[model samples]
Target: MSTDTSARWRLRAHAALGALVAALPAWASAAPRFADYPVPAIYQGRAAQPLLADAHSRNYATRLRDAATEKPDFAGRYVLATWGCGASCTMSAAIDAKTGTVTWLPFTVCCWDADVEDHLEYKLNSRLLIVHGARNEQGGGTHYYQFNGKRFAEIRTPPRHAPHPPGDHQ
Candidate 1:
């Protein structure tokens, strides 16, 4: 082959190789896998059994709703769990009556193995906000948030309290 032809062929090969490398990350991110984590030992520990047992034995949804609405000074909390696609997850939420401060703990099982990118947003003066899930092994998810009477911007920072299970609802 001529030298100029050979050189052009090599340049095209290098360009093709570079393009393939650049496309790799985008392709990898397009699909992800979610792996379930072992249930927390706290749920199995002696001291924690009673608490877990109580949770298993009772349904407190009605009581929670009542407190949030009936009592002006009520600070309410609850946990909810569900099973899906052979896995289960939970979400919890709490609110302070006096300061109107809210806290939540959101988690999933068998959803993803990647970094947990949970973002919570609360409106400045309103109780409505949005929660965004980071790229997990399970792809990604988003949650619509609302607060008591007030609409507020969502805050990405962690809240002091860890919400249980039920509060994961959008």
Candidate 2:
């Protein structure tokens, strides 16, 4: 090919490569991969037995490995795992530090906040776990839960106000 023709071809190739590289991050982020973050050994070691005993737990265990977002050392002795089952549906499980016991919390509906992109929050140095969920058409609210030696149980009254718009309130 002539010099001008070859130069044009090279420019087009460079542009195509640049476009592909630029699109990679968006493509990768479109689906969150749980495998990217493996469950910690503390939880993984004890999860096999209980997970194998029941089919549902086994499925959840797989999903946990595939999609769950883990917070290690949560509450000083527990590793908290959260994953989305579907739109607005979420599930959580906790691994006890002392016993390695995995406790699966009830499946919660409308637990996702599209605005903030998170469903769970924990207070520093406090045992309170605030779970956000939709209450009605107006908005969503938070339910406070406390780990009561056995499981996380809802304590104290939930927030009464509607969920403020993102950036309006935190």
Candidate 3:
């Protein structure tokens, strides 16, 4: 294709994608708020040692173990352990404070849009996980996820119902 023809085609594709995103359901396109997915209650028991036998966990055993020492930083009873993979790239695993299970994030977050302040945005008492970057360096966009006890699932839509924080209005 001619340079001009290719440029026009790319522009049209971008526009089409934007229009589709705009037409999506609010929950699908909108970022989930931290207050919308609060845990019923925070875990109060002692943090357990990370189970290093988990798939891919042994490679980062030391890091995960060190992170296990800290209180839960994600969901209700999980500590988010993160490490830099390269420039503007990071890998993370969620260490269960109650069961010591390790669940890695679905992909390496990298090459975020310039507007994103944090690559990973999460709340200590909520299951919503916001990724403000490309997943595995495929594309640049904001992705919403929910911790499903085993792994983080990309959210195409928010839960039909979820508990709010203790004092927040319904």
Question: Using TM-score as the measure, which candidate wins?
Answer: 3
- Per-residue CA lDDT of model 1 for 94-160, tens digit only, reads 4333332333333333443234343443322333344444222244454434444233222332322
Best-first order by lDDT: 3, 2, 1
lDDT of each: 0.35, 0.54, 0.81
Candidate 3: give the clashing pairs.
none
Model 3 TM-score? 0.73
* Per-residue lDDT of candidate 3, residues 1-170 (tens digit): 99999999999999999998878765343555777888887898999999988558988889999999999988899999999999989999999999999999979999976766677888888998877667898766666788978988887433424322221212
Please, what are the lDDT tens digits per residue for candidate 2 over residues 1-170?
Answer: 99999999999999999999999866643321223222333333333222334565677766545322343445545666666666666677765545545677654637445565556765323455666675322345655566653677765433445343342122
Candidate 1, residue 132: CA error in Å? 9.2
lDDT of 3 at 68: 97
Span of 10 residues, lowest total lDDT, candidate 2: 31-40
Q: Point out the worst 10-residue segment of candidate 1 by lDDT.
A: 41-50
Query: Better model by TM-score, 2 or 3?
Result: 3
Cα RMSD (angstroms) for every candidate in the order listed: 15.8, 15.6, 13.1
